[model samples]
Target: MSKTALITGASSGIGKELAIIHAQQGGNLVLVARRADKLNELKQTLESQHKVSVYVIAKDLTNANAPQEVYDEVQTQGITVDYLINNAGFGGRGKFHERSIEDDLAMINLNIVALTLLTKLFLPDFVKRNSGKILNTSSTASFMPGPLQAVYFATKTYVTFLSNAIAEELYDTNVTVTNLMPGATESEFAKTSGMEKQVYLNKQQRHIQ
Candidate 1:
């Protein structure tokens, strides 16, 4: 039977690429993102091209209740998620003291709390069934302190550690957890984080120019 994957942040960036890959492999999808339009568009494209079912859930994962709501919705739809890809997160570029507290909190909520909650909600079912895979989108920033993007880096550290610990816990089971630590890539992340003007990006731009 073809598997089903639930992918958050499915509207754009790496999350979007993951969805396409799963579809190409003949797997069904539950695509979650705040942008319904983009989700629908991807759903149409993937379904037409790959003949896989795609369900879109537009939600802001920063909200405390969003993760639970997503879980409930999946249950209501009678979808058994075979793969859980927690790829929804954003970063803000600024010193910890200068950045907006609200933004930082939202980052924590989405990057840390939402990922943990979704894993918590889904892993039990995986354990009960003795099969499932979890792929979390952590970052290279997890390794060290980020001078400007402090909270973002710290949140990624939490993700890396949490994912590692849980993988160890499930070693006896068929379930698996993988953390992806990608460096700077061509994605919405740079623009969303306001890092387009940063030195590295500027240097890259100059080279391209």
Candidate 2:
């Protein structure tokens, strides 16, 4: 039987691309995103193309209880997640002190708290079953301090560090954790983070060369 994978932020960008890749590999997918329409569109596309089952969970993971709610929804539907992709994230840019505190907190909630909570809640079954895979999305920004995007950078650092530590602790187990640290990929990330257009262009140029 094909493994079932749950992916957050499945409405767009890397998350959506990962969903496509999973479907290509003959995996059933449970996609979560705040946008119901986009999720539905994705579900249709994946199912039609791959002939695989697709489920969509529309949620804003910034809510403190959202992760548990997601897990509960999956259990309600009797979906056993063999793969979990914690790819949901948001970014804050510009001067740290000048940035909106609400945005910063939301980023913290999604990028760190929700991801960790989901991992903790779902990991027990994986341990009991002795088979599972987790892929957490970190960024190259985790390596150095981001001047304009302070909170976003810090949150990714936490993700990378926490994921690596857990991976080590689960070393000999059947569970495997992988972190993908893309170096400023071509996505809406720069725009959402309020990065300067020129800076984004420069980065894109460097990425291509």
Clashes of each: 0, 0
Q: After superposing candidate 1 on the true structure, give the runs of residues whose Cα lies further than 4 Å from its correct spot.
A: 199-201, 204-209
CA displacement after TM-score superposition, residue 189 of candidate 1 (Å): 0.6
lDDT of 2 by residue, 72-110 (tens): 999999999999999999787678899889989989999
Q: Give one digit per residue, the lDDT tens place, for model 1 in 1-209.
A: 99999999999999999999999999999999999999999999999999999999999999899999999999999999999999999999987898989989999999999999999999999999999999999999999999899999999999999999999999999999999999988888988888878857678888999
Among all windows of 10 consecutive residues in model 1, the one with the lowest summed lDDT is 193-202
What is the alpha-carbon lDDT for the whole of candidate 2? Answer: 0.91
Give the runs in model 2 whose Cα sits over 4 Å from its true position: 196-209
Question: All predictions: root-mean-square deviation over Cα?
Answer: 1.7, 2.1
Give the clashing residue pairs of candidate 1, or none: none
